[model samples]
Target chain A: MKIPLPARFRTPVLLMAGLTLLVALATAIGSEQLNFTLTEMLIRMIVVIGLYMFVGNSGIMSFGHIGFMGIGAYVTAWATLAPEWKQVMLQGLPAFLQEHTYPFPVAVLASGLVAAGVALILGAAIMRLNGLAASIATFAFLAIVYSVYSNWESVTGGTSSVIGIPTVVGPWTAVAFACLAVVAAYAFQVSRYGLMLRASRDDEVAAQSSSVDIVRVRLVAFVCSAFLVGMGGALYAHFLGVLTTDAFYLALSFVTLSMLVVGGIGSLTGAVAGTLAVTLIVEILRACERGFALGGAQISLPRGSQEIGLGLALALVLIFRPAGISRSREL
Target chain B: MVDPLLRVPQPTAAELAAEGVSVRFQGLAALSEVNLTLLRGEIVGLIGPNGAGKTTLINCLTGFQRPTTGRVALAREDTAGWNPARFRKAGVARTFQAGRLFRDMTVAENVEVTGVGLGLDRKSAHSVAMEVLDWLGIADKAARTAGTLDYTDERRVGIARALVLPPAFILMDEPAAGMSDSEGEDLVGLVTSIPTKFGCGVLIIEHNMRVIMNVSHRLYVLDGGRTVAQGTPAEVQANPAVISAYLGADV
Candidate 1:
């Protein structure tokens, strides 16, 4: 007799299969023109999936995920930039950072480690407070990181931006990492810690009575999510061939959060669908702005129209389909 | 006529014990100087009027509320400051008064979450959940979301969730509050067999007098956070103290 898959795993397995097909289709159809965009979108999916790990499972919102992303981007930028270029780009940098250039993979891994370490410290304090307080604390953390990245000019290229990083993130690399992220999230959602976190979300009093450590569970999810998001940021930094603190600002944070909310806050498929849909929508909007001139004037749909659209979409989703588009499946 | 206090048997070695346990919130005593023991292989009914501190005592024992004074020893360990996850690892499980099922999850998923801290693998945990559902006669509703279940099935699902963990001690808070007599009987039957079938201790806080009288091996009556009476069904029924507390002293 064939052993049937557990109910929980069934949806995740189907989601993985669907994601694999999308990756394959992206590879095949967009051999050249759409390859770069596809890779970037996949990398963004990684960050959003990481966010889903904590927010989806624990029912807590976090604004600190992008701070970890910023950390990863800068770490990867510092580690992978050549010594001669770094010496010129960052004159007052320490000798070790100015002298060594690690391989891209090593730099990415280091970025994730550093982000996880930061998350561990920050989550200890932030995870203690729940609801809006925790959300605001995390947002404040992002602002703090943004301030440091902007002011610390010598090492981080401070506001001016860092250049000459090798472009190593191609379609396959992005697809592979995205797959890794999805699998990690799947494993975590089914794990003991994830169950406890969800239990805490469902009923705090009963979860406590059952002896679940809510803080510890939240911290685990937070750190794990940060690590993956960091890796995704590192990939984005490498793919774009440039690094800047601006790239990992509040805009990016809001975008990723929108992806999670619009897709389905708690399900994996929601993360993927949200990322793909939001990315495609923004890209199409940008294309429309470039392609069509409104009333003989160059079509400029304001500076942050993309953000406004995403915000409106989020509000609409919350009001109409509160559970998200893929409410039934794990995705 | 049997003396009310004489009919109830003393707790056995495998029972759950609490000594001088007190839970205070902002200087208000929820449970003060409370001492109770629930024996293994027996159903102990905890009955009290609203706000008599029955739920608070249950919460303290199950790790939801930390006692301000004294300790709760389950099986053997001092569980005074233990959190819920730790309590589950120590083989203690519980159900809530309102039947807090995972609204987004299926009935089977609800049960599977209960087996999470049992050190069982996912497949094994799922199998265990299915078995519990089947045992409760709700296996057919396994695929349905817990939120959509009828009140009766939801209560069954709650019981199944607790049973999936196979805990050494189960704390049930108002299992029959909104249930019909038939439904309440079914729940009572399910709870009474837990000790024999799963070899676990049960401490139930209940309001339904018929269910309590029918199922509980022993009963403790709480009035104003104090144990007003403790005895068998017949003895408790005859106890003037319990009767006065329940029906007022006009009789």
Candidate 2:
């Protein structure tokens, strides 16, 4: 008799297929309300999977991923914005940057490339450090990037933000990219480099003795993760028709990390679940804020309550599940 | 019979050598001015007491720790300047005490990573990994995660991982630490056979006396951060220093 596929492979295949079909159907038949929500959640899903590439494989917690997203968003915004509109928003720009207007796909590609390039430079330095030191170094990197984005008046439009980004990322595009991210993340997880990265994470001494180039493996994941996260950022920039350094700040970093932590740290399905669950929770909180008006007293909740909720959820998940919702298993 | 007076000329190179290597942690000398040499195709055992510098020597050799003084050379090429991965790529591989297999990875996957690290393509690495697993008699467990294995099996898997890279030198830290008598014997047999089978020098740090006596062609006894004795197993076991170190004042 032929042996059946193991539960591990079977479960993920079935779950991924179901999710793909659900996303397709929702994008096709659902109202614009549902479509927009699914699209946004799918985009976040891509970002989370990108996070999983580095965080999951290397078993390192990073606070610098948002730095990559900022790089992508600004690159995409600069590429896709109309020349005259860019002049109005950006004012004094370099001659070469001002003259060129890239197509949407080309802009997204550029965003990923720029992010990977930055990751390559940064990862070479950051991956050398170990454990909490590496964590602190990456956090410092994020802070530095955020500060640069907030202060760089000409290139990044300063803290005022850059608007008039092209609307190229829609519901279908988001779903398609999310699927691609899932496949890419899963492929990396199963590849030789992925095994080496995970081995290094599990046992540094053994990995070293085995001659595994831990730093190089981590750089691979770091650059790949940055590329995907940059793509997600480009999609977000187009979806919103605006881009800001603040859009890719620590708050968004924490949100994305919370999704990964609350879902599961090392599993692809956990990334998607965490993103979808967190996004829905934020949407619901927003709806409650708008809908609730008690007895004309106007008892209004403060903004960004979703962040507080997410933080609490992350803490509770860490305390209770410890391995996040999926444990070490995939969705 | 070999002529007792005939002197063999010294080889042009020592396969692996440590000169005046010392590792001090907070003024405590874990290893002190240790000098060792292993010729090609030799199996050497490092035997010591609990606090003896056996593991520290291995760590220094593998580039996990920098020696406070002196130099380590592999094939007469200075390795003191090399990092762990550089050491590994330059034909050094190691196995840890308690078998530090990647818990989340399958046994075959663990070996495959080692093969890949040695510059094998994926298809070839997969086959090589399976071959190693089969050689170690853990082929059936190839699909099983390293964490799911028993202590003996995990030890075997660790050896398989080390051997997959086919390094010129393999350092094993306490390979027989937690094994039963028969398992330890099997490990001793496996390690002893590696030099002939794979043509790789083996340096084993083991606390198990039976394993040391069985597998080691030459043995180094260390105590209090110094070499107490070095000789063939029969010669070393009969040495006053080795006896005193092991038996204490009772001897």
Using lDDT as the measure, the top candidate is 2
lDDT tens readout by residue for model 2, B1-251:
55321221212333888888988999999998999987768999998888898888988888888999998988778776788877777777788886888998888888887777666655567787888788888898888978899999998899898887467788898887777888888878878878888778899987777768878899988899999899999999899988888658687
TM per prediction? 0.90, 0.91
* Cα lDDT of model 1 by residue, B98-154, tens digit: 898888777877777656544455556677788888998988888898889988888
Overall lDDT per candidate, in order of appearance: 0.82, 0.83
Please give the lDDT score at residue A104 for candidate 2: 89
Over the true interface residues, superposed, what is the Cα RMSD of model 2? 1.2
Instruction: Please report the candidate that would top TM-score against the real structure.
Output: 2
Candidate 1 docking DockQ = 0.40
TM-score quality measure for candidate 1 = 0.90
Worst 10 residues of 1 chain B by lDDT: B3-12
DockQ of 2: 0.60
